[model samples]
Target chain A: MEAASVLERRNFNGLLDALTARGYRPIGPVLEAGRIVYGPIQRDSDLPIGKTDIHDGGMYRIADRPDDALFGYNLPSDSWKQYLFPPHSRLWTATKSNGSFTVAAEEIDPPRYALLGVRACELAAIRVQDTVFTGAFPDRQYNAVRDDVLIVGVNCGQAGGTCFCTSMGTGPQLTDGYDLVLTELLDGDHRFLVRSGTATGADILRELPLTPATPADCAEAEALIEHVSGHMGRMLDTDGIKDLLYDNAEHERWDDVATRCLACANCTMVCPTCFCVTTEDRPTLDGATAERWRTWDSCFSLGFSHIHGGPIRTSVKARYRQWMTHKLATWIDQFGTSGCVGCGRCITWCPVGIDITHEVAAIRTEEAVHAHR
Target chain B: MRKPKLAVWKFASCDGCQLSLLDAEDELLAVAGAVEIANFPEASREVLPGPYQLSLVEGSITTPHDAERIQQVRSESEFLVTIGACATAGGIQALRNWADVAEFTRSVYATPEFIDTLDTSTAIADHVTVDFELRGCPINKGQLLEVVNAFLYGRRPDIPGYSVCIECKRRGTTCVMVADGTPCLGPVTQAGCGALCPAYHRGCYGCFGPAESANLPALISELRRLEVDDATLVRALRTYNAYAPEFRAASDELEVTG
Candidate 1:
């Protein structure tokens, strides 16, 4: 068993101060523009302590929670994707001089990040992205920033209306991929059960004024995590999901879902595993200078499938099928795991309320009927 | 080698898409260096002869003379690219396709005889074979530049074919539909505007026109399920790209069903 310690609710600000003192910029949840978004954090006040978000298909809003516990809600709209893979990045710039052009690469020096209030599902999502960006070719820009970031994960005591992480076996309690793990126990004592998962985490733990966690505290944390596991708002049936999707390439359910799917790419944008990008050249007005930039791209777009002949996935049905199948089926073949962490952002963010879980269920139901026949 | 002669032509449009080239403030001088702006009445009073290397035509065919003028423009240019919703999909004026155009002309114009316009507004592709069609109400300046760059480089332009959802996802924008129940047209609409409307906390109005293989029936039914009235659904499809085949078909089908 890993070593555990108790951090009182009042002393939470100390952890932020300690992280800042160590030169790691603390980034956590912030209530901005009526939504909980991730940005710079200095103290415990930055976290949406008493705020919880109400999320449903095509519906999301911030509401006051009954208690004042940090990380008392589900995933925020923006994930840590921005910190790892930014929206826009200039790759190289070329300046024309005397009929010749000289190209220079942009300097890449990422800041040391201490990600606070990270949920288990998000950690899993990060790992999924890690496999993508650090694969055979390796994205240098992503690695430059991702290699130094420290993960501070928070175990979910309760699941959100859109949360299906338990079903995906990626959440409620993080067993790996985090430097430090925290389980907030608001029962008798307003304290947190903190456990160091890495040497760096252990070093940070030594600096904090923490007490040795008793067995009762550990048991309390265990019970809460177990309870959250069984009480998820949504569940995905992953039994042979890869095979099921592969088998149902021509499934009518895809056509049904595609009709409702706006092909808006909202799900992919909110999705933590998606990694498609397209590069464009921006030349200066004087034609003297030019720069190339890589922006996030999606399979839902027609240009994503465009070739010299024409676009392969010209229809909404085809594009939506490509997105869902890639995330659930082909991802396993490519990365040894499902692209989805079951964070349920895609389902909640879909403009038309087209639920991925529901789509899978529809296909599974059809497959069962076919099997019976 | 001499620079390729480039020209910009306008019809019945707001000239917003043509202005997009002008809006390429930083890249204008660079692009100008690569191509000679022979005839651009919007930016310059100078008129160059036809037989141009590349021509960027904006607006829809709303008049008989403009229709004839397009044929001449097509004959003169080696490559013709239609820019924006007006050129690629008949534009917002194509809303007249659903109603009586004579009634519209009579109601608006003091002397209806002076107004010589076609009953239907049609995309440039409907009249002539366009080399490429760049979608958007006011085409994205970046994409417009990409098109020009591709032309100069003798390569295919890299424009997005996916829905607005993809762009929104790239930007990490919150889904307004899920977050606020805003009935966005992003899923069915072609992407290029960088999911602009969603970032501003409003649903997309399909300013970029319909995406490839847009499923109008499915989107319409889903919107209806969301309590969007039949009339509103029809109106939604009849927006910027009202004359676009996919939107036109959907709107027309709904008009009959309602």
Candidate 2:
């Protein structure tokens, strides 16, 4: 199939029709309970079109946008993890009768999904999770769903105040890891600069009505990506960051963050790439059968590291430290990438407004002073 | 010979910790083969009368009934293993220790007088002798498996007792506190979680509890110089394992001055 592109009103309904006709379960952003959240899109009308979200530490509110664009904001409270790694999933079942026991394995069947308007930073977060779930032992459940996903990456035209994707080296532009990349170009008529990175994506583009890339469209897309990249409100110096955090374990900065941090695990929960999980069991009404299930877990929870006698991270200070260190420093060793994609979700959803970028900069400055001494 | 019988018990908690055992999807079948699940009410409706070989208890003794029930559980089980921060420490509910119980009871429930509860929620160890205790707000399943396996094999479980710093080093995870000046509890926390928090670019809140021979005086001195106030330090220590001896002692020493 030859690669092609199609132009619609650049509104929600047009994108929905394009996604549905392709036999994909369209998932997009919608306003729910005064906040933007990712959920199933029945049609274009379901999306939060012409809507922008106001976000800061401990706050998120939706505001009306003048332009009726499908992808208008950085991110909402929900991340891609909600669909990929669900909050709870049954793993297996067990049954026993008359001293004889048998086990029943639960089958994992992920729906064929079309992720619409995925921001560049979120794409980076998805890649980080791909490495964690698929790179190592290969989580059978995660792989089952992730394999059939059709990702539609969108270039960020506007950066959120909390956004730091530029520093994470994973955003502002869709470089790779997508079926189709779209750059929204509003030139009198709303249009998109669509490019295909995979054969499947090319096939989809072939089916859609699209014009060959004009030099002006290409130039606009490039300029938009670069402009958005530079407009990032936050930055983190990854250079020697792992060593800086690891070597100064007793630094005084942790106490500062711990004071405000509720240790609510909301940051980890909302984080697109945080994949820590724990499990539970439920027995059938008959009491003859039992099923075990897996659920999302957070390091911030005192129970996450509970051992034989007590919790390892007994204090709020310890839990906070463990979370930051693992995300930035240890993540490099575990996944060969920083756990944080600098999506800014942690900062926005955090009830106390603890900004990760500010925390990293503080550490950097402290290290610099120590170096001089 | 019949396989050893295993039982799971819960007390005062969110039931999240006991759920960790059931979360071991890959090893669930293998685990079932090794033991007879005798009394896990959360997982099985069939309550096999115990003289259980092993009992995995979650949550803490927060009520009079729970305090008495723990003794019964200890009497019925050969091996009693407490799981999660609630079972090993007092858990978040232990925050009640710092406030007036009557006021708290009135705020949450309508008939505070009818609710029979203890002034302070305490770990199982305070009521009965525990064979072992798993640390964490929710204990890690991998370590849980090791402990169960060790009991089955009649040997001591090879669980690490050093600080989380060692696990971070062994896993080649950089120290967030050292490198980024992020405050971390890896230096004082017991290693079991494989240094999960540090790997995720966050400071340790000591969910795994205190390590053996933890130098709290030094940690406090550094924190103080770092401008950590006594109230903040006290609140930090009195989290999941607020009742655990080492943590409890440290937090007690940092009581708020009027």
In order, what fnat does every candidate score?
0.75, 0.00
TM-score for each model: 0.92, 0.63
DockQ scores of the candidates: 0.50, 0.04
Counting only residues 3 or more apart in sequence or on different chains, how many pairs clash (N, Cα, C under 3 Å) in candidate 2? 87
Best prediction by TM-score: 1
lDDT of 2 by residue, A150-184 (tens): 99888888888778888888888888888888887
Candidate 2 regions exceeding 4 Å error are A1-6, A10-15, A283-287, B1-258
Candidate 1's C-alpha lDDT?
A: 0.86
Q: For this target, which candidate reaches the highest DockQ against the unseen true structure?
A: 1
The CA lDDT at A257 in model 1 is 76
